[model samples]
Target: MPVITVKLAKGRTVEQKQQFVEVVTNEAVKKLNVKEEWVTVIFDEYERENWASSGELHSLKFGEGFGMKGIEK
Candidate 1:
């Protein structure tokens, strides 16, 4: 069994996550020759404040400006 773990900043709809899982699973199945059922896609959502880059918080950097609205909601 192949286990895939994905860590992304929180704030995506269920549909989006589902799409990601499907695409990732498909790719794993095709490229890694893993069974679709055996492919595991795990998503770990985190608050914008909890995820940071370049020593700056995501919410503070992009939430206020940068068209990142609705990402925290």
Candidate 2:
């Protein structure tokens, strides 16, 4: 089985995750020569505060609740 792990800042909808999984699964099946059923994908979501780049936390750099609906800017 092919296990793939993707880590990203949390703020994605189920639909987005579904779409991403579908694409990754298909690619793994095709390029890795694995069966669709044997392909496994795991999402490791993180808070923006936990994710940092360029010595700055994403939460502090991009503001809280980026891309999430109903969140105050």
Across 1-73, the per-residue lDDT of candidate 2 in tens digits comes to 8888989778788999999999999998888898999988898988888978899987887776645532344
Please report, in order, the local distance difference test score of every candidate based on alpha carbons. 0.78, 0.82
TM-score of every model versus the real structure: 0.78, 0.83
User: Model 2: which residue pairs collide?
Assistant: none
Q: After superposition, how far is residue 38 of candidate 1 from its true place, in Å?
A: 0.9
User: CA RMSD for every model?
Assistant: 4.0, 3.5
Task: Give the C-alpha lDDT of model 2.
Answer: 0.82
> Model 1: runs farther than 4 Å from truth?
64-73
Determine which window of 10 residues in candidate 1 has minimal summed lDDT: 64-73
The clash number for model 2 is 0
lDDT of 1 by residue, 3-46 (tens): 88888776678998899889989999999998899998787777
